[model samples]
Target: MTEYSEISARLAALPDAELTTVLQAATVGRPAFWAVRAALDEMAGVGHIAPGGDVSPTTESVQTHDQASGGGASGQVGAASAVPVVPVHPAGIPASPAAGGYSSGGVPTFESVRDKVEQRFGTAQGMGELDRQTPAGRSADEQWEAREKAARERLDQIRKSVHDNDNP
Candidate 1:
């Protein structure tokens, strides 16, 4: 009488070899793979699987002046006095929103600095992420790991260069 009942009857008739093949293709842990798993689970009279949940992206962000602020007014507008003048880079000038704020441009704010960096460098630091394999496809995790590795390597390079310059 129900849609699930029809599927259950069909699955029950499946040969052992065919069922194994279907399970192999289900991809229990992959995206969209879960839809197949859920269906298979229903066919096998399996109970609910507690959603393992999603893994969110971990950003590699350094502290800005706002983060160090201790005052209640720090996170709001007109908190410029408390806002730290964060350096755009180790060698570059500090971010300043100019006297007129965004109304007039001199030294840009942190948001502007990020935009300019992207414009000059292109997306994902020119890592060519979209050109890589999808997570469901092979090499997806490896490509992401490679990007993180490259960033860490660049940070190490920056640290070393600054350290070397300090002595000279």
Candidate 2:
């Protein structure tokens, strides 16, 4: 009935690949993530921290030594507290994924490649009418193979032309 619950439900329904994407997205631009992680250590009876060790944040209840004095402590505590060493995927890498599990010009995972394909072309359902025009039971895969061969042949011709131009 609540917003969190709704989000949780929707997240639950998604397949694993989509879930991975959402989890990856949530970590971005969220400095608070590191603070909570530090707070958890204190909750497990870690009263004192090193001069400058990692500190996680917890709910408002997990107060530090300075908090009892006044409202200054309150300023520090909240949901977005815990911070991690590496931001999971911090820099150089991108937030919006291209394809697959592989990042940074790497080959995409199968699902990521499929997702890209669907985004560029229409969905399977959207292509259904066109597919029906093909012989029944002749899958999309079959058509793709034929098309790929044709593309390769065309690419070979282009390559030969370029090679001849440079050499002659």
Candidate 3:
């Protein structure tokens, strides 16, 4: 089997949540990203997946304009592309907007996942097990803390200076 087919098979075997996670984590400009996108597109093409993680099929057709052809008479002909339609909520909001915080299309956003990780295990700036055990790492951490404190003080001084200047 071809590489794409192999990848597509693996992706298709994954559950929806896992597949969405892989799709979100995939880096652009890579074969894996394209494969994941194709898998989702296939799901959408079939009636298996719908917006907001619904199982219903979409029947909306979107128009595709050929901008390269200057949208002339020929360009307008056969330009309609059939795509899955997203369902809208009663409040006039889309079921899943790409810019929505936390999650989109039932996939947790990177920021949301990062925030959860940080809450559970602390931020990346915290020292790791190896760092905590090493004298050099401990010293480095202390130095970083001191530098940050000094920077905060300097920023406060600058803010005070600016405030005084504005008042005068």
Candidate 4:
């Protein structure tokens, strides 16, 4: 019926991983996200989200708040004045520490980025389409395994080279 209802329906239909991916994509440079974030910050400042002592955004409990604020089904208070002023954080993520913002500090170095990419690649390489028939003369699982092994070997060699150079 309403736009929010439609969005809620669609979101409800998505699996958890897909919903997470969708939310992540929505946060990138989106004006709507920033606006809601600002609203939530304001709510926190005035004591709606959390009242005193180390307001980590993740520790808020808003289900009852959402229902009170006219978000009976969707679990989101659409109006800014509504008790649900944007969710503090999604479910399952651990609450942030109270003392400092969630940051390890400083920009990531190229080496760090490279290492992360390689790690992710290594993790996913074995997850190739094993069910699908490969045109590559080899079975899909064999192909994937071979590719993963080669990639791991390459990463190991690169790491060794970098380590040797750093020590030298």
Candidate 5:
């Protein structure tokens, strides 16, 4: 059977409780979540849902699904799908064919940024996230500012510890 047909059958076979579990675990804006959502919409559109339920596709839902799936009727997939299948170095930087490819020259590549940030601020950021959870009256921006402050403080403490260790 075709992949879509297999997916449809699998979707059909999924018990309501299991389907609900899957839905609960699915994160919004993720491809897998969008795929399941689209499949459900398609199934409902084709009269697969029980008669008592509201299975009719709303214009908003249809538009959302179409956008998420890269708008088949628009003659091209959405911009998200337009990204190259293979990871490539940013423009003007030729990628190395060697394992763990390097960008042109010793200049920092996009991939290295995450590792550097984590190495520098991971502990502090973790503490900051926890700190932001408290002090409930603050707005999101304020909370973020507080988190940054906490991270800075933690980083300072780390620097002091490292300096002390080196001097002693």
Candidate 6:
């Protein structure tokens, strides 16, 4: 049997509740959802199922502007009418021209490049200044010296303990 006939038979054999459950469980984007939806649509006589399980509008439902207005006897839709037209532009760029009649001409400036780099890698300025800031209540150099003195005192205490242990 043809694949389409097999699908129709399988769908027909399913109980209404089981069919509904299968429909509910099917994901939107996958082939299973499209196949089930197409079968259901065909069984209901709502529309014709095209190849690849795409549902096309019924002859009675689809009417072009020309046909609606009784203008064209050919019954053919124009290329422009078949699909929609959308305007696309780069992000953050205006679709219309500016007030001064000046355009960036799609050229990258040093300032623009630097701003993009800063946005991606974080701000390059003020980092060194942040690193050089003194600690609270004391300069960094003084804090380093204090730490060094403590370490030396601890080393001296360890050495004395070792020397006393050796003698004992």
Q: Between candidates 4 and 5, which one is better according to TM-score? A: 4
In candidate 6, which residue ranges exceed 4 Å CA deviation? 1-130, 133-138
Candidate with better lDDT, 5 vs 6? 5
Deviation of model 4 at 146, angstroms: 52
Candidate achieving the largest TM-score: 3
Query: lDDT tens string, model 5, 61-159?
Result: 222222345445546533223321222334454545532323444345566677778777988888778766776634776867999999999999999
Is candidate 2 or 6 superior in lDDT?
2
How high is each candidate's TM-score?
A: 0.20, 0.21, 0.26, 0.22, 0.20, 0.22
Weakest lDDT window of 10 consecutive positions for candidate 1? 57-66
Instruction: Compute the lDDT for candidate 4.
Output: 0.52
The parts of candidate 5 lying over 4 Å away from their true place are 1-138
What are the lDDT figures for the candidates, one per model? 0.50, 0.53, 0.55, 0.52, 0.53, 0.50
Task: List pairs with backbone clashes in candidate 3.
Answer: none
Q: Candidate 4: lDDT of 119?
A: 87
- Residue 111 error, candidate 3, Å: 22
Candidate 5: the clashing residue pairs are 70-78
User: Model 3's lDDT to the true fold?
Assistant: 0.55
Best by lDDT: 3
Q: Give stretches of model 4 more than 4 Å off.
A: 30-168
lDDT digits (tens) for residues 47-107 of candidate 1: 2223673455332222222333453354653233433332222223243345322313235
- Evaluation by lDDT, superior candidate among 1 and 3: 3
Worst 10 residues of 6 by lDDT: 78-87
On a 0 to 1 TM-score scale, where does candidate 3 land against the true structure?
A: 0.26
Per-residue error (Å), model 5, residue 15:
57
